[model samples]
Target: MDNLALIESFGDFKDEKGISKIDLMAIIEDSLKTLLRKRYDSDDHFDVIVNPDKGDFQIFLNKMIVEDEMSEDDDLEIELSEAKKIDESFEVGEEYTQEILVSQLGRRSVLTLKQILSTKLQEYNNAALYDEFHDKIGEIVVGEVHHIRNKHVILLDDEGNEFILPKENQIPSDYFKKGESIRSIVESVDFHGSKPQIILSRTSPVFLEKLLELEIPEIQDGTIILKKVVRIPGEKAKIAVDAYDDRIDPVGACVGVKGSRIHGVVRELKNENIDVIQWSKNPEIMVKRALGNVTVNKIEINEETKYALVYTPVEEISRVIGKQGQNIRLATWLSGYEIDVYREKREDDDVNIDEFRDEIEDWVIDEFKKVGLLTARSIVDKDTDVLAKLVDLEDETIDDVKQILKAELDI
Candidate 1:
């Protein structure tokens, strides 16, 4: 261990930046300290020292000096004549350095050192990434759209790390232009591959909640609480809000004076529809409200099953069900119940057996054309009650079949 050889073993620490010898000494000392701790189980015996000028590191195993004839375990005995050769005052209890060879370490020990250095470097990188994004959670960050696959939008964040915005987590109608910058809140950070993975999202309910918190001071101040939110991304969202403080109106605060506050959140969601509703402790009231403006005649709930059967006017059925069942689906999700919608039957529109039979019979006869039974008149004229006898149908079934045939034949 000459100084020059030890320094060269560290590769080049100086290039354009030109690191000083002291820096190399510190690095080597720290490296050796970690290596000794990992390699040896002893507590207070081993010590490491680095000399900048010599570019070398030294390891010392502390031992007490003793007389050559002493039988004490605490001392490494040397004759008095031999001790005076090194120094005149070299006492019997003094400690001495014993040079260690790096080559004396086994292959595993070298591997352990390499692993320690790699792990430390990775940890340093991870720490740097954490420092960069720790303060950015819940805040919007812009990322470039790299590619879209399996409904997941792959985005490159500001740090050049790829983040995934799962398709189900993205607003359906929100299209990302290739290479275009998309803005979304940093939903979460996960450490992966020596760096913090930044997860971004636009369709998360938290995004709306955060947007409200930003726009409405009442929410941020803790007066207003978001009770529940149901969203059909890029289509519509229903938010139920309540105020802990009586002085604050949660819905009104979120809606602004004339829809200003909520409109801001909607705009940020790419102009998605937002309905701000006052939260209610009553399940019926909350469910009715969750169904939006659709009028419910009555709500019958099976508590055990958590199912709600809502009766509404026939015209309002479509309203409650929404387009393609979005309304009912959102209502169910928000209300945490299975919902079955029922519409009241009009008085004049009561089902008549003859009319029903006629309608069905007409369909059957029309269908029978493909099977060569084209006319209800021909079927009804049969003597053995052809439908009941031939098809072995019950009386009611035969009668229904006759009516369907007649209706189908327009007879």
Candidate 2:
């Protein structure tokens, strides 16, 4: 069983691939046992063992020594007279071990074992790759852009692992060039085929969180805490942060001097707007702050519905809504509420428009306010037919609703 060369050869090969000796030996021994049973007798009992120092293995057959000198089956049954030549102490009808050599194992069996070991090594390497990167999900990695496909960029990470940066995960404003550096968060890891699949992203909210952790030393050291972050990807994001120490301003820290700290993140995001909001336990205050520069005169909330009605000045409406509602969209995501920003308006007759919130449909309420019909008196005093046409309601529908308002107003 002195197979030092065989073991040394495998050891050298596996060492280069970072495979452990125990794992390789298990694969080799298992393959040999399968080969031995397949090519030999199905009833054969055997055990395989490898000498660690010599790097050699032996296949020993457990067979009985019978006194039947006429028995022709030497593979499983050995005659006592013949067995005595090898061992003088051998007894009749007793089981003994026979060491089979590699030559006796046959060329076909050895070749099959080689193929099995090769396949097992590939599987081992794939599993090793998976184990190495599975914990890196959500962490940032620096990579060099190796190649760009139709919808993905192949990046070689710092550890020399190839990660897939799909177009969907990347910001729309980002462009890829070969040999350029790429920084992104690890979104996922999978051993799809021969290699581990690492998916990277630059647009995920987690990426923004990582960037904040990177740019702000206080956040990393825990002086400042990021309560929550939500992004609309390439357009805008809202991040709620708070300072544990009153002396330290979390919002100011994140914004940096002259917009320096935030500028790093903004440049990385292709100039995407990031509103570092002062996190508040009160949902009303948080919702108002999430609107960024928009000044909120008042905030009304329905806790059960998680809906916020924000009243800002008429000039601040566009800022609250942002371009194409992106600001409001991200604000809603960050504040955990459905926010509807409104401008405060009073009827010329000093009518209370807030009372009509329940009377008219939510959509038509804005049109009525826009037309200066800010009160029940305004709606009821106006011609009901003309109101139906103006608000796109049927005459009966308008009359039925307005009658209730008229009776309440005692008109």
Candidate 3:
């Protein structure tokens, strides 16, 4: 291409990529200077003046005039005989200035200039993308699914910026088709070489936090503060929220009437069950609230070990633990404590070991039965070490047996 065509081509690229004109000019000048150095060995004696708006540039080379045979480097010192051809009065020991046309750079140098400019512009774009997304971490975004792969899904924003939703970062129940609109949080931004990898996550706790902020004006306006969020992705999630004002019920406000406000967030997360609870400074109340809003009869906390033993009514035990123990697991994470649930014993109720024959091993039940610990409560009430000594079983086995008994009897 001619000089003007080349510059105009750069201008077209700049406009298409949404690059600033000043940045494009800087890249162009640097590219040209790089080519000058490659062709002339050094660009120190070259003056490059560029006018990107006018789509043109000027290059002038300066060399000291020397005797024809005495010229050591043609790039820095031109022979006097050659200088005299351009101007007869030209003499040795003086500097000679000559204009270098872009066309004179030849086809190979022009192609090299294009390559350098394209590389620089691409690097600039990647850096800009990284910076923009880095600052936006933990913020939610919606993008169209452009491609789905085994390990990750590629999403494109309105402006066509690519984001990656890795399989591990997606909710367990999440499934997306090409061209589907997906909403997620910008979890992280990193560089794999010069390419910026913008990672989006649908399973992050921050994703739920951001969704709550978007859906609830109380949260967005700072009237309610989201204290913490913990999740099992598509299975269950728990968020602790607090409000400074006594009149405002943070949990009820977030849940809305008949679960109106949080419905959208739940649907977006593939119907992940969310439990919103009021945060409290008292660890016992916090632990009780974290346990899926269950009515705990008692809570014994060991602050140094960050562990708690919660006793709830027998009927509330299943709800406290949830399906597959997800609720209690989330409560443990949210409360910063290792929680063990116990059923509040009643004098009238006791499940015989034979009643748990379906859940406990025959050999395990026989071992407990032999010790006269026929009732499920009898096994649960004893410590692991004491039970192990009485039942001729390992502490782990005794513990497992206790768990099975407790689970079956709703403890």
Candidate 4:
């Protein structure tokens, strides 16, 4: 191939499947640069020279000028006679270029080059993917539902690239229709081989926050700050917001006049229920607000461990915990605290509790207190055998505690 043909081949470096030539050349250059960098530990010192005339690619490695060809193993050293071959006026201490053919590479050398190229290209693609989605992390991207696999909804972007929306990432009430356009946040971007894979989500609390930011001008303008969000996907979400500007009510701004702003967001989210509450710095208040629609009688918070003991009416326990403990789980995640629910002991239930009066109550209570279990409610919730092991109690004492707990707590 002539020089022009060789350069044109690089320019037309497309695969038979119609991949871009420039992209292929970039992949090749990236591959070569990685290999040379690792082998020489200097990426900038090597120049890749592609000669179309000789159908060869040469790596012009610049070595330091050395005096006297004393080291026989130095391939960089050129004897005065050998130096004269390329240039008759060649000096003893000058760097030179040696032409090498790609075709002359052995099987092992070829394999090494292939591996280096593949690895570098993958790394480059991953970095590119991260850069592409990092700026768009809070923004929504529209995609078409393509197919379903292993309970995950596969979606296609505008470029026809496929992305996996895992089952856990999808909103509960939102059913995806084939070829239907769905909106979601670019939760994350990962690189696999030569392409980028985007992770999409609708159930993330961040999705609701982003939607509010999109709909509410006050939030986008920094007058209102979204502090925390606890969500049960399509079922319900509780958002805690604060007002940076005293004149603006954060909750009022999110609700909009006649509830327009939040309604728009709710509509987009398939009419998922939302409760906007004023954010409080107090851990007790924050935990109470996180358990939305549930009336909390009292809350005791431990600042050191970030745990809360919450007491609620017996009827509200299921509502606070939600189906499959989703509400409590989301509340804990959003509030950054562990919450244990308890109901107050009733006076009428004391008759049943009196049956186990004499059996090891003081010993179990002392052991429980030593191990940080300060409440009778916390002790009654534990499994008798595990609690016995934790407190180093005899099996007979554990059995007595279990009966007492079963009678008192109705467990």
Candidate 5:
């Protein structure tokens, strides 16, 4: 290829691909030098000059000027007669400088130079991508769904960098179609070979934290510090927050006015319920808050075992345990304590469901326990229709169970 044509094509590529001019020029120079070394056995006497802006380059070969009869090494020495023809000032024992045309590199060598340049450019791009993502671990990123695989989903960023969202890293309820935009945190970056393997995760606790940061100005600006975050993916999450300024109600700031601030975060998480709790250094107080909307009567902590026993009103027990035990699980994770729930016995009226397991079948008692009704009082407090709706039981069966319990209590 012609010098200007070659330079222009590479310059256009550099601009279109967002490569630095200095880096592109260096690659070009190195490729040309490689071609020279291959053809002449060494590039020690070749100098490559490139003007990226003007898309022009020059290659000069320097040789020692020697007597016409004494020019034994054609690659390292030029005859004075030949040097004087180009410049009469040329003298023996002096260097003769001559411009070498790109066309002189021959068709095969020129093709090899282009191949080398392309390979080097690809390598540089991969290195740059790896560095960029390595610094973004735990930070959020957005990409478009490109391909869905059996184990993961492939996404393309705005710059078309591919990222992997493993099935395990996606929220349980998360569903994305091709061409849909997805937001996730950069879980990790690795390299199998020269390609960057960027992993994204929507199920990470950091993803929830980042979403909170994006939605709540107080958290982002440090007015309210996010102390901790724990999540059950698309089901529920709890975050502990505190602020240096006592006047700033950290929970209020994070939750916003009537959930105006947290609504965005919830939507992004596929309607995951998020509970914002005021942070406390005392584990007892923190565990109480982590239990969310429940009104705890007392908390007993065993610090050595990192365990806690929580007592709440029987009616509030279901709210504490939540659906599928997600609430309590997240609360335990947030507070760093394994918690067991108990009902506060204000009167002798309440009785454990196990007491009636002989009258009620074991499977029947299990159904009630699954809905968080562990006490006879909790079951009786619910209307028969409500209890029937909560469990897979007929209304008449619920009424019969309540009547038997009531007869034992003499209510």
Candidate 6:
């Protein structure tokens, strides 16, 4: 075999596969040692060198220069006369080396070298992929869709690496179209089989957070900070935000002047309902805002258990519960609390219900008219539990409302 052509081919392979030249050299040296041991049957120590500037490949065996003409161990020593015959620079008791050309390693080694190179290349490729994506977990990636089959998509990123988007990781409102652009977050990177696999997801909460950062400049610049985010796939999502600069209204800025900013993120999410609420240190106040489309009259919390009792009006119960509890579920997830919702009932007071207009949830007053219930004074004397069913609330809420009315009527 022509050693020059082999070396040139390996150089080109190293460049194309992103394999380090030094690593290839190590593999070559290892392969040469194995070949020499198998073919020459000598356990003598030697060093392999691939100095392309000097020669394609060479193997040098170190030997001690002895004054005697013959040595007891022929492989480990060379007589001074014999060493001088190979290289004029030879001295007794000095080290001498004999070089063997790579071509001389011979035709029998060709198959083994090929197998070894193939295995080494695969190992290097896996290493390169792992290094490329280990820190990219949870990062947003933009790629072009290359192929789609059985609801799974193949995408090629800017680096020319292909990524698979499985059906389960995709949002229900989204579909992969060939040759279209898609954006997703890196869910995980794994080495399962022969190669490293990068798993991508469109339904992940990080994807939504990234989309917000992309669309809203304020969020990206830290003017509006995203505190927490939760998603129910294509159905609903809620994100809590805080204002680093008090001048910025976190929710209003995210929502834009006329819902323009949030609209961009909503479009990208395929119109998934997004509720950008303000984050509060008080879990009770935060849970109240997390109810999305529903308004909570009051929130009571059990901090140790991370549980909350949220009271909304009976008229808004359907909105609070949402479609199959999705609204409340996302609210609970965003607030970091397990919330139990209760309908709020107002206690009858000597003063008219209209007197505390700003203090009560609007839905409660609407329900009063719907049920033909009269003034607050009428239900004041009624039993708390029975009045709860009449007003669609819990007894605890009714008692709390009575206390509130008494306080207000203290005049």
Identify the candidate with maximal TM-score. Answer: 3
Clashing residue pairs found in predicted model 2: 3-56
lDDT of 4 by residue, 1-411 (tens): 332343345443233324344555556666666766655565565677644344445556554334455535353455666667667777766776664343333455556666775566556556655686867876788889899777788999876667778888887777877999988998887666556778889988888888888888888888889888777777777788998777778888789888877998888888887888888888888888888868899999888998999998755666777755677887887788999888665643322222222444555657666787654456666777778778878877767766766654675
For model 3, the superposed segments whose C-alpha errors exceed 4 Å read 52-55, 81-94, 312-317, 342-411
Tens digit of lDDT per residue, candidate 6, span 38-59? 6657636687777634436677
TM-score for all predictions? 0.61, 0.77, 0.81, 0.60, 0.73, 0.73
Worst 10 residues of 3 by lDDT: 351-360
Judged by TM-score relative to the true structure, which candidate is superior, 3 or 4?
3
lDDT of 3 by residue, 231-341 (tens): 999988999999989999999999999999999999989999898999988999899889865788889999999999998776676677777678889999999999997
User: What's the CA error at residue 77 for candidate 5, in Å?
Assistant: 5.9
As a whole number from 0 to 100, the lDDT of residue 94 in candidate 4 is 73
Query: Residue 74 of model 2: what lDDT?
Result: 74
Provide backbone clash counts, one per model: 9, 1, 0, 0, 0, 2
- Candidate 1 per-residue lDDT, tens place, 280-373, comes to 8777887898898888999987779989899987556657877657788888888877998775764332222232322355454444344444
**What is the model-wide C-alpha lDDT for candidate 3?**
0.87
Better of 4 and 6 by TM-score: 6
Candidate 6 has an lDDT of 0.78
Minimal lDDT window, size 10, model 2: 345-354
RMSD of 2: 6.9
Error of 2 at 7 (Å): 2.5
lDDT of 2 by residue, 8-40 (tens): 656766877877667777777876776776777
Q: Please, what are the lDDT tens digits per residue for candidate 5 over residues 1-411?
A: 788888667766688779987778777888888888888889999888988676577999999999978988887799999989989998898997779888886888878888888888888888999999999999999999999998999999999899999999999888889999999999999997878899999999999999888888888889989889998888888899999999888888887788999999999999998888988999999999888878898899999999999988766766787766788899999999999988654556467777665578888889999999998889888898788889998888888899987865557
What RMSD value applies to candidate 5?
7.7
lDDT against the true structure, each candidate: 0.69, 0.80, 0.87, 0.70, 0.87, 0.78
